[model samples]
Target: MNVTGDDVRSLALSLPETTEQFAWGMPIFKVSGKLFLTLPEGETSMAVRCPILDRDELVLAEPAKFWIAAHEAGNAWVRVYLSALDDREELTAIVTDSWRQAAPRALLDSP
Candidate 1:
């Protein structure tokens, strides 16, 4: 099964409750205006804001696209190749994690 931008959007929307918008000319999934993920038109790959340690690990594992050591957000985010995802299950988990981190507990508690 091929992953598409629609899949990305759907995954993001599936989160508890969040918002979608664009930033830096790319699609951004956020909660209360803070970006959680960003991807270009095709959504072939996505960048998730991460801590310095996690970013280091990802860059070492996949040096080609998972660039770091020099970035706009520096060590605050890392790009994840959509193709690197073993299956839709992993993709969903990762996307959900990003959303959960971005979404505040209060928002999730909202009825």
Candidate 2:
């Protein structure tokens, strides 16, 4: 199933304490002022928090769906091709994981 920008926005914003902000002409989602997700490349893709090692592995495992932008290569971020996502559940998982990474420790333990 293909994921749209609306899907990205909804899933990201549904996460605990997530908020949206505009930057670089794109919608970015943050957890307590820390960015966790962003709609980039005409909203066709989304960048999310992911460790460098894991990002590389994901790209290698699914080049069609995962990649690192040249400008973001130095950061712990991975780009996911929305059109190539497996389904809503996968998108939710990705957004949730990214949110968890950016959320504060207190938020993580909170109910």
Top TM-score model: 2
**CA shift at 20, candidate 2, in angstroms?**
0.5
What's the lDDT for candidate 2?
A: 0.93
| Candidate 2, position 4, lDDT | 92
Candidate 1 is scored at a TM of: 0.78
> What TM-score, computed on C-alpha atoms, does each candidate reach?
0.78, 0.97
**What is the Cα-based lDDT of residue 81 in candidate 1?**
71
Off by over 4 Å in 2: none
User: Tens digits of per-residue lDDT for model 2 on 1-111?
Assistant: 978999899878878888999999999999999999999999999999999999999999999999999999999999999999998889988999999999999999988
- Model 2 RMSD to the real structure? 0.7
Question: By summed lDDT, which 10 consecutive residues of candidate 2 come out lowest?
Answer: 10-19
Clashes of each: 0, 0
